[model samples]
Target: MPLSEIKIDDEVFVSEGTVGVGAVRQVTPRELTIYIEGYGDIAIGPDHIASAHDGKVVVKPETLPGAIQAHLEHVHDGEYRRPSDT
Candidate 1:
């Protein structure tokens, strides 16, 4: 299963490690924005997503940090401002 097939509100988890869990908040053609508790919303790309199935999306643990960074860069480029950025 690919990340492109993930549905909104589906539970996502770091299936390979003890990272964290989150819910899919938004989905786009290029990314999946997940609302991770304590970490806020992070957009994950296909490269970071290992698989998605049975109402759960598993992300590659090693790519988690990079995904978060990419999301931050994306948000900074858009009009939406994260609270911590203020």
Candidate 2:
């Protein structure tokens, strides 16, 4: 689904993981930011999204790491990097 279709309050579900459920709190041209109770906000792109409708978004858990990296870079202005990267 296009990011344009996503709206606030949309519920986000991962195919499988401890990610549980999250609610869309903010939307931007690049990603959708969802708030998960215990996990906090996570920024993600549409590539991992399997489908979206009826105020819900289903995503692939495997892409989570890349999603997070995008978030960090977006917010930090390239000041941070994956710890293991040389």
Candidate 3:
């Protein structure tokens, strides 16, 4: 998704990366900040984001340094997110 489109509380995903999911905490012109359990908050730049689909931002794990460990958060797969959900 476009950086402009991302917002606080939005969900994030990983593509062949460490953190499987993240909760968006902040979005700025430069990057998107997401919080992962046991990992804390992380800022993701556009280059690492693979794509935007189904209202989620998919990021590449390799792009995230020091994110070697792996874990997954609840995604509620296929659950449609409403505008108010953001």
Best by lDDT: 1
The lDDT-based order of candidates, best leading, equals 1, 2, 3
CA deviation > 4 Å runs, candidate 1: 16-20, 66-86
Instruction: Spell out the clash pairs found in candidate 3.
Output: 17-61
Clashes of 3: 1
Give per-candidate clash totals. Answer: 0, 0, 1
- Give the per-residue lDDT digits (tens) of candidate 1, residues 3-48: 5678999887767443336789999888989886555987778998
- Tell me which residue pairs clash in candidate 2: none
Q: Each prediction's TM-score against the native? A: 0.66, 0.65, 0.65
- Which 10 consecutive positions of candidate 2 have the poorest summed lDDT? 69-78
Query: Which numbered prediction scores highest in TM-score against the true structure?
Result: 1
Candidate 1: residue 50 lDDT (0-100): 85
lDDT of 1: 0.72
- Which tens-of-lDDT digit does each residue in 1-86 have in candidate 3? 46887768766777533334667898899898888655678777889788755557777766667532344334444447568854
